[model samples]
Target: MNLRRLKYFVKIVDIGSLTQAAEVLHIAQPALSQQVATLEGELDQQLLIRTKRGVTPTEAGKILYAHARAILRQCEQAQLAVVNAGQALNGQVSIGLAPGTAASSLTMPLLQTVREQLPEVLVYLHENSGSSLNDKVMHGQLDMAVLYDRAPTAGITSTMLLKEELYLIGAGDSPGHNVDLADVAQMNLFLPRDYSAVRKRVDEAFSLRRLSARIIGEIESISTLTAAVASGMGVTVLPESAARVLVSSTNAWMSRITSPTLNLPLSLNVSSRLPLSPSAQAVKNILLSLLSKPTIEDRELMLVG
Candidate 1:
């Protein structure tokens, strides 16, 4: 099967218009049409049916489309792997990260390392909640992601990077010290929006305690929520990594949440089925090494010390 023709066919079906696909592919519409036609001829079946509305894939077309997409993805991966093998630590790496996980202590150091060691590698960072990042990584949209260690998925591999403690953070003068879950429930809380692993855990803890916490705000960005907590708007529960950054910069104080010490397990998730590119593997190795570094834990301990 002609890979080019297969790709053209997939593009046409995706755009649902030969003209649109041609515009995207930067080829003449007639030429694009010919490619698709040739592919159908080679397959000995009608792959697409053109209607006044647009092009629609035939039943055979759908089957071919599925296989074609996978084949193209595999081919692209193969090319990336080959290029990466020849050029170690030189390539583009797209990493997805959960909201609070991208704070200074975690992602910044890794990015700095990439900048220094793999200067030729272009790094793209996408910030989302842990579940969203996990889905993106699983779908191959992300090379890897730092995510909360929830349950594992079938086609994704997760390696525990660290076990972090969650802290109750509030303004320095807020009427809180050695707070309990009940006291936390009484105060208005600022929290990350739903779908965040932190929010899910907080909700679960609240449910287990049969406590009704008043959530005053649901901010999507951890920075925004931290700012709110700093301003004495409300208290929030955050990973020690995030809380330490806030307390160090602003007049905020954080105490480890107890009654049940919230231990959030962080993980590095990568595609299990796809072989990682050498560059991606190199970045992953650096990240794993960083996670193993006693210095990281010592820094966290120093913050409390």
Candidate 2:
């Protein structure tokens, strides 16, 4: 029941040898063995099976190891929270984001707000696909992330920030301002790889229409896709938020897909089981507020409509 003994047992299992664990812990091998023995005596079970090569956990040991890992992680998180309390909002927060979608849409605004509100907090951003981001967040590697609603982990809670309308962006007037699936089927299109949520929706839309799109190129980044569309390479279906900045900068037109407007809801996901620090909570509040605010264009479109 001693936390220190449990720590020693974890180290032993991790290194697979008492000698290695002792060296890492900077203790004598005999002392490490005594600690493991004491733990085994307290638990009234053999935690490890020794072989010539190394030690392996028994069935009970595996269960104990699983619980012990969670305990140790919680303890470390507690220590970090205590240490961070004395300092000003000064701690490292690692955030994961979906590439090309969440980064341009919400990440920049959140970063700016975090910088202004919590100057002492260091923000580390990682960009990956939605599936990778979901995995990282569930495993506690990332504090939070903005991802599509398709992949939601069990322990994570999500709030729908906005539903972005997907637009068919093409060169030279967008082929009559509002094109149908029949119109898009005739033209060559550029799309992202299969892993993208947007691509999946595009495929579904095309399938529903009983049509096939002529895919000329597959690019990953929004910048590249915009450049391709601007240069008359091909047309693509992209979220309005993701394509808004690019279209504005390049003077390209974006019209909502008519046959079926593709709408992807962006969600802010955070681990409900983990305790959020005050600084992290503050940043989360700001982000939630930002999501509530309507963009100028959104207000204008509402008035016009």
Candidate 3:
């Protein structure tokens, strides 16, 4: 449990010999052995089994080792962060953006702000399906992500940003005022595969209306999808903001989804499983604060579209 004991344990396991660990640690073999024994006692578990060559950790020891490594690394980072707190914030931040409306809204502002405020910090931006982003966030691979507000997952935290209404996107010549969900069954639709969050919701909405979407094509890339819609391959349903951005890209128009209007709340997701680095937390704060203000107005999105 003690930090020093954990270090001793990990060193011994790494070097495969108590004598070598003591040599590397500049401590006596007897002292190192005592520290490990004390650690095992505190946990009431057998941590190591003596081997002819040196030592090997028990199953419990492996678990402890993994956690101990992370803890020690975090502690070291905390110290460095304090030392550099007065200076420019410098750390790597990996953020995930759900393609379409999310990119048009959050990506530029975040990049511009971080460049101005934390020039020393490095940012990695990834755009993918909402479900993909959520998976990465849930696994701690991403520091934060933007996803739809859905039923809670175990290790991810969500803060609802805006309840965006759905819209029907089609070629510019296509005309419709308020399209009903059930009517989608009659039109050829281009949608992401079933794994995608948007497709899942779209399918559910149709099912609720006792209708099935006439899906003519499956495209994962948002760019390809917009091009397909522009060429009049088929129509797709999108959030109001996303619809605006997509329509602006090509000759397209949008009609609000009505008749049991569907509204999906966009949320900012962060991993609750691990403590975010100081830089990441700072970025997270900026994100939530910015989103708490008014969402992108229809006029603002006109530029991106």
Q: Against the true structure, whose TM-score is highest?
A: 1
Q: Candidate 3: where are CA atoms >4 Å away?
A: 1-76, 295-305
lDDT of 1 at 176: 52
> TM-scores of all models?
0.79, 0.74, 0.72
Clashes of 1: 0
Q: Cα deviation in Å at residue 269, candidate 2?
A: 1.2
Q: Name every residue pair that clashes in candidate 1.
A: none
lDDT per residue for candidate 2 within 121-167, as digits (tens), equals 88888888887777666545677788777655676888777777788
In model 1, which regions exceed 4 Å deviation? 5-20, 28-70, 80-89, 102-104, 172-177, 296-305
lDDT of each structure?
0.79, 0.79, 0.79
Q: Which stretches of candidate 2 lie over 4 Å from their true place?
A: 1-73, 85-87, 302-305
lDDT of 3 by residue, 1-305 (tens): 77888778878887889888999999999988899889999999999988888999899998787667657656756886888877877878888887764545767788888888778888888887777787677544678888765668766788887778878899855558887776767888998788766777788888888887899999877789898998887999887878888888888989887777877778888866567788888888877766666555744767677
lDDT of 1 at 185: 88
Please state every model's RMSD to the true fold in angstroms.
4.2, 5.4, 7.2
